[model samples]
Target: MSSDNWTEQDVPDQRGRVAIVTGANTGLGFETARTLAARGAKVVLAVRDAGKGKQAAARIAGDVTVQTLDLTSLDSVRSAAAELREAHPRIDLLINNAGVMYTPKRTTADGFELQFGTNHLGHFALTGLLLDRLLPVPGSRVVTVSSTGHRIRAAIHFDDLQWERAYSRTGAYGQSKLANLMFTYALQRRLARHSTTVATAAHPGVSNTELIRNTPAPLRLPVTWLAPLLTQKPEMGALPTLRAATDPAANGGDYYGPGGMGELRGTPKRVASSPASHDEAVQERLWTVSEELTGVTFPVE
Candidate 1:
């Protein structure tokens, strides 16, 4: 397979590997979990709904289990992490593939902006809690799924991180996605010393998935009109993430996405993010703030 055109078929064997895929019940997360399990990985569907997770597991053909995880609640996050720690002594892949997009203004159980809480903070705490399991394992990776939206109306918003005053759905979603990339960079930097587990990020481009159910009416019109040109199916969308998780050439802090025009759709390949996503100071600041918010500290460094 060409490095520039990697596909699911190119995913190496996953036998004996234990992978935890958040939101594995549907969309990109589901596709990602299914592919990994099919490749002989012992996959855990870390979903919000245990019933839906079991339903999804029933459809896959390999070692698959379900774990309930609600990203909006810190209590649930901690509970799920504890359960996962007990079940899996080591984790080969931790895919933070769950997220919300363009959601209405709302707060999480912890009173943080919904998108930011679920998309970044939840995953941050989970990774920190589980870092020890991956540290000793060679080739272990933490793959967080970011988005092209990270570049649109995205900022750290340190002044009012929770969107207390006002909120733009798109802006909040963008900030969350940008934070995902920054988290990966910051974590990878810390993991560099360990030299075993690495953190990577990926985007699905614009794939046709249920994640778009919350698109505001105005944006929905354009997306619907250009759906043919802008969107690919969920299977294609899962490729970038799969590549980022499994590619032997992949390095810490590398990002993967569609290799096509405007990065809207195409084969999976190494991709670049906005300059804002690469700001080291911002990455460190976000990491610090995330730790403060989640109350979970990484064992790294």
Candidate 2:
């Protein structure tokens, strides 16, 4: 396998594997689900809208199902997990690929900042709730998709986690993405003893996806102009995630993303995250806070 130019063809056979991908209705998640299903995995599109999810599943020619999941609400997350657990006694993959980017300031049903709640906390809780299903399965993995946006104005912001004092869409997004990596590392540590299930993270870099719908007005024109040069298609964007989820060599705590200039776009490869994302102290603190906020605890702990 060419590590530097790894592509979807590099994915190994996934026969009989049960894979769940959040927000699988379109873009990166859709591409990820499509490739995994093509490789013979039983793909479940866990999306917010059941109708859209079914539509997407129908378009993919493989064994696929739809599970309604709205990450903004803890109730919905738990409900979806329960349903999934009942249907799948064992899960081979859980991809936390659903997320909101640079949205206007708002709170989720549980009252956390929209981006943080939906992007990091929602996946954190879901992973904890369904971790038991992956624990016993050999070679099972939990792959969370993060982004390069994690570096811009990113921090734990322990003092104002929800941005009650002030708000910047970019800052909130950064915090959420950074938390994704932190959660991956922290979860990997807890799963270290099990040796069967691993936790990893990946970023799509800059992809031309619906996620950019909320781009601030000022940057819209420039972003549109640079899109062709800086952004990759969703198919290419999903590669880093595919590699992290199924690559034979992908291990716990590994982070994968584009190998091109500034990791904006190109082939998927092993990549490094920001220094701040590696802070174990912050990671543990965030974990504790997440447990407190979501009231969900990991069985691995």
Candidate 3:
């Protein structure tokens, strides 16, 4: 358990490390990448838009590069992994930070729910494909960003994974975020044998980011009015993830989030997740389903 004041200044030196952060074009991902790069890590801004990615890299003051990665497309994920593996044979950190929030009922290019496909499945395949590179590097970490939304009407909904019967944007978004936590737990258990690599999870407590673009109109005004009091800046929100990615004391399967009330808007610290997120059965089942859906298998047992 970290203290209630674990700010970015507490992050240890990251010189000689290599980090890949998805969706690094803006928001929390950009802050995470920028902070790590500032500390001397070679950071890759893996995003879907090359122009935006290059623009983001230009804003950072360290060795930052851009790579194309569209999580909605498995083909793109594979290509990105191959490119990353060739460029960085040993990855010290892989931050699964890309995600879509509450959007209208939609499916990915591969016909899966957009949120689940991109947030969970895409990252699942990418991690499996790139696991080999991290395995040889001691202390390597794969930090997946989940969300507080996971506790809001979240369930695996195995039978209706695609929400074909009915779709509530909130429900689908929660499911995807919950999947992120489950994936972290399951991956950590599998990677336990290697002792070289670890899996962790983090959440930014209600940060002011572009992720809320799809919020219902009714709640938009109230949210905007309360933003100053309810939301933290993106840089502050990135603390938990940065800590999870670089904290030497952070253990596999550990979850980091804001230390403030309701795990929102404060410094980073170890935090507890919803009870539903701790179900081993659901985690295992989701893992199997993800493997089948993505056609990607882990190197671990």
Candidate 4:
């Protein structure tokens, strides 16, 4: 989309919808939840910290619910999912919004690398586990928040996905974000082939968010100074995601991001990806590997 295209007011009617926004306590996630709720959707703030999430929702000025969801733990994922299923019964939208970046090497409670485990695997399992309920409610959508880092950090080291052999915080972060996009595209293709639920991805162009709190001082110094000049506010970056989740014109497999300065910061825009990302083989492999790792197959058929 052009920079001068549709504005936030262009967001479509979202009444009667129920959205589950992971990490809805702050950053882009919080803005997403707030927008959805204000638009009349019952937004559920799924976060790791219930207290913080409650406070965030309380400030949203809309219908918002607080729910605990720690993406680093499969057991936590399962429990939170079960709670949502039991309580809401159906979820019309799922915003895979939580993520970690440039952190010290660590593993999730499930033993997988922290970045991939939480950003990709957790959402993989959560979406698959909740598939039944989501499918029952027609026109449901799953929006995975991704990033431009995929361009800098291509290639999935299947041999050592945990990065025990080699680890660079930036590289690991990029790989994880790429996996989010790959999963989004692959899942959308799978759904088109055999199902109806739509899958889409978006990136908040260098938005100032807490995802970078743990970033190295060297990296943070430049980012801290450059963000205000180059990055859009979290609310602005959240617009593309909101569009993906609510707009009926949003097609499955389409990607949205900033259109200005190499997609770094601008109004919401639909963009393309590298050829490697578009490779069908890689996406299928990633999908199969994800299913095996999570032990939760998304039966799109």
RMSD of each: 0.8, 0.6, 1.1, 1.6
Give one digit per residue, the lDDT tens place, for model 1 in 1-301.
Answer: 6897788899999999999999999999999999999899999999999999999999999999999999999999999999999999999999999999999999999999999999999999999988899999999999999999999999999999999889899999999999999999999999998668999999999999999889999888898889888899999999999999999999999999999999899999888999999999988989889999999999996
Determine the backbone clash count of candidate 4: 1
Model 2: residue 68 alpha-carbon error in angstroms: 0.2
Q: Predicted candidate 1: what Cα RMSD to the true structure?
A: 0.8
For candidate 3, lDDT tens digit of each residue in 1-301?
3466787777788899999999999999999999999899999999999999999999999999999999999999999999999999899999999999998889999999999999999999999999999998999999999999999999999999999999989999999999999999999999998656999999999999999888878888898999899999999999999999998899999999998888888998899999999999999999999999999999996
Candidate 2 wrong stretches, greater than 4 Å: none
Task: Write the residue-wise lDDT of candidate 2 on 7-101 in tens digits.
Answer: 99999999999999999999999999999999999999999999999999999989999999999999999999999999999999999999999
Which has the greatest lDDT?
A: 2
Write down the lDDT of every candidate, Cα atoms only.
Answer: 0.94, 0.96, 0.94, 0.85
Show model 1 residue runs off by greater than 4 Å.
Answer: none
Candidate 4 C-alpha lDDT tens digits along 234-300: 8888987987887777899988888788888877878886667787888888888988888888768
**Ranked candidates, highest TM-score first:** 2, 1, 3, 4
Please say which candidate is ahead in lDDT: 2 or 3: 2
Worst 10 residues of 2 by lDDT: 187-196
Candidate 3 Cα errors over 4 Å, as ranges: none
Give TM per candidate: 0.99, 0.99, 0.98, 0.96
lDDT of 4: 0.85
For model 4, the stretches where C-alpha displacement exceeds 4 angstroms are 1-3
